[model samples]
Target: MRHLFLNGPVQNGPFTFATRPGKAVGIRLAAALNAILGLPPTPHLWNTVTLAGDLRHREADGPTIPRQRFEADLITDKYPPGQFPVGGIMTDTDAEVARLALEMIENNLCAGTLTISRETVPSCRACGHMTGTGSHPCNACGSTDTEDRTGLHLVAELAKDRPVLDRSDIHASHRQQPRHLQNTAGNVAERLILSRTRDHGIDLSPHGLDGLVLDPRVGIHVTVLAAARRHEADTAVMTITENAANHIAAHGQHFREHGGARLQYALHGYLPYDHTASLQPLHEAYRATQAIKESFETWFLPLFSLRTKTATSPEQLPALFKHYMRAHLAQPAEVNAAAFNAVQHAVGAGNVSWITNKQGLANVMAARRAPIPSAAGPAHG
Candidate 1:
């Protein structure tokens, strides 16, 4: 396949899709695009490596359960009963992802782009957790006692000749390039430490950094690539918010491409899910069906977020719903091969214009109604 859309691994936090639908925007957007392209549903990716996760695990059951099982259970709980993802779920700490990450790190080290060297960092004396900067107790153990400890770390030297994030790193059209994100992401220290003290993650001990794990920011990229590799896609388009992209772009500089698959971020805006209740009146007015309601909430809104690239206003819901209804009504009885092909091409090119075009939207709606080979199997988690 030419391209596959994947979510920038959603953090495995304590929340359900019903309570926080906004968190699933990336997953919904990717699924919509993949369905449009007639590609099999790709696995929903998750980021299980986090300081918060470590503390939660430590506090619950006192490490009686395996960390991987704990994370998987949390991820499973996010979806409603019997409503898991169609293609399954992949976490950042998946064995395949960890292997691919180590391979990439080794390659970067060999090229002199990354090095394992001694560096001093703040550490919690009681818990041995990296305290990071500023004045604060350790997040893991809530210990005020900390010390500067020198240890081997995986370090990446920022490329002197290039901005940390450029147009090529983004999957949007030239006109929609995230210049602001590029500038801000570039404004970072010349060097970055890519290893962290995490209880559960892609362990760097195999690479000589004992007790350290590959930074989650970088592991997220590898997770996407690993998913793409499973599907043999050349381009892995990750749907992420501009803010999250800025936070992780620098660390993912060298991790974006590996083994012939290149990764790119498709920046999206936050949706006002809290205000979606306001749509109830419109739903009643339109006498919307269950499928129509889902299409509006999960598909159309997420796609619109890409075009907005900022928080989508709740005020726009009525008009957006009207637009979706119009498109749904205009869907041709017979699929338009030419129009459908054009829409697929646009999707692969990261073009959001098609999403707002009446004819293009109609064509997509028609395609969604038609049966495709990839849609034959039962949806998975």
Candidate 2:
């Protein structure tokens, strides 16, 4: 599995560890105890020590002390000036024990780890190549001076192995930080850099057996990455909507009559979040001429109205107009001119009649057969 090793403050949602030493202590404790107990050890005891109860308490011989302090006291169980010779090995053994405990804690935190995105990609003094993988000699210039980097390849690998994705989205600073393990409050700079670098041109693949290496340099250009991500997200969403439309077109008329709101909701979430940027090229190559916007609306609206048990929202009117335009602009589809005319006519400008009635036609014909209007108001017949 893709493992992420971070050396920093651990923030589990609302809870935060006050000190780094606390984290170190926990890791060291886990490691030491595991070694002493042997593999496949009993769980009840380990759970009791590490997770169940607090171990920092003084023996009934003295004043109460914190668990850590009490544990220390046990090793140095001495006081005052002693006139007798003491064991040489007992000199400051408490400090040694504390140090060992910390090491064990660190080991436990990192045990069984196949690969870590944070440590694999180290920062360089020169060009920022955060990913651990680099061409043996720089591929760009065939020089040995090139640095390796990492990014999405690691994320992809983690996804494949199912590492219980704690957090997929991170701020730019979090990405830049080497030990971005907290899964929250990460280095945003690193994320943006990696995203941009990859966007320009970079292959991101995991670098472990059934896992991937993540590079930190990929955070360079966030704007480009965001744009690309949005495009891709949009395309996928639209594809689904189009498929829904196609299904309705082929299967039955009910969807065609009442599916606008459903389609709207789908597009609402899909469009802004799409990842693929270049859609026009795909459309042109396929010679697609369907009015997707209108089709989507037609399918969604009726269904939405039925579910809500109310008329369409007034706010939706403008959106419908925009959809109408999008549906008609592309070559694959044609808007119904009659329907458009009817709506326009309801407004003042289009209400005038363009056609002449029979009486008007007759008057025109008679006028051509007779003389023009007289000067004195009206001439005698």
**Model 2 residue 240 CA deviation in Å:** 12
Pick the lDDT winner. Answer: 1
Runs of candidate 2 exceeding 4 Å displacement: 1-117, 122-125, 131-143, 146-381
* lDDT for 236 (candidate 2): 10
Candidates in order have lDDT scores of: 0.90, 0.24
lDDT of 1 by residue, 259-321 (tens): 889999998999988997798988998899998998889989998889886788988888888
Residues 1-381 of candidate 2 have per-residue lDDT tens digits of: 111111111111211122222222222222222222121211110001111112122124433554444433432232224512131211111233224322322332254221224433532325443323544543222345543344332221112242211222111122222122323222122211121122111222222312221121111111112221222221110111222222221111111111111101110111210211233444454453565432323322322222121134545534543443343342122222333233223211211121122232222222223432233322235
User: TM-score for model 1?
Assistant: 0.96
Which whole-number lDDT from 0 to 100 does residue 365 have in model 2?
A: 24
Candidate 2 lDDT score at position 299? 29
The estimated TM-scores of all candidates read: 0.96, 0.16
